[model samples]
Target: MVGGVKEEYQAAQELLTCMGANVVYCGPVGSGQAAKICNNMLLAIGMIGTAETMNLGLRLGLDPKLLAQILNMSSGRCWSSEVYNPVPGVMEGVPSANNYQGGFGTTLMAKDLGLAQSTATDTKTPVPLGALAHQIYRVMCARGYANKDFSSVFQFLREEEGQ
Candidate 1:
């Protein structure tokens, strides 16, 4: 009765949970979704902050490549700076080099952040970073790069700075 196929989504989710299948990678309202939502929020915020930091570097006359190199070697570096530097010509491994191709799509990121924000609102949890991440993602979609890698947020920053 509880595992009816009509709404098999939640029913299967519960059955798996009861069976100790905590490491699931898909389906609705599972741990995977939770992890995805949380990490996307973190990733989005990281991209935003990385963009701001890179903006500062450009303003200071530092070559993005040089700044990226140092950031990769230092505590200031993160996944965005080291593995996914958004500035073209700064990093070789990121999708940004090929016009921001590959990596997580921005539309999915925005959706994840929006989901997290809604969950936070329902739970009365304050997630300012998540909210800001959601808004920035909206801008990315508005700018027509929502299909690019989430790291494409750097492009948004560069545009905002009048460069």
Candidate 2:
């Protein structure tokens, strides 16, 4: 459910419906933002986990393409691993294939993760991974990859490991 000012909510619902989005009214003013933060937090975690797994596979003598196929067909499968692989050449027409450009930027992802962390802290939620993901993105930003796609975390990790 999308929560907002009544008129604005109705207008938003209409626009979303027109755009083929399945719109539902969530609750109150901040609920939509809350949902968005939660989604972004999970997405961040998935992307980071996928990157780490791919890197580990590479270090263990697994071919990137074969490893990706294995992961996609197994329990390790995720949107990041199957659809938007972080490793270059494993997929085509994604941010990673384009030098990590023109996709969700690391700075924006960091901001979303920060929002999730703030909300989690306020609610006393034990979001260990979310907090860690926030720190990782913060470090990425500090190391000059803020403008790159968030999946570029793979690159950051690879470089740090001298891979």
Q: Quick one: best TM-score, which candidate?
A: 2
**What would you estimate as the lDDT of candidate 2?**
0.93
Each model's Cα RMSD: 6.1, 1.8
lDDT (CA) for every model shown?
0.81, 0.93
| Residue range 2-119, candidate 1, lDDT tens digits | 2223366565677667767553445344556667677778888888898889889999999988888888898987888877888988877678888888988999888999899988
User: Which pairs of residues clash in candidate 2, taking residues 3 or more apart in a chain or in different chains?
Assistant: 1-24, 1-25, 1-26, 2-25, 2-26
lDDT of candidate 2 at residue 19, scale 0 to 100: 63
TM accuracy, model 2 = 0.92
Counting clashing residue pairs in each candidate, in order, gives: 0, 5
TM-score of each: 0.79, 0.92
Cα lDDT tens digits for candidate 2, 1-163: 4778778887677677886567767677999789889989999999999999999998999999999999999999999999989999999999999999989999999999999999999999999999999999999999999999999999999988887
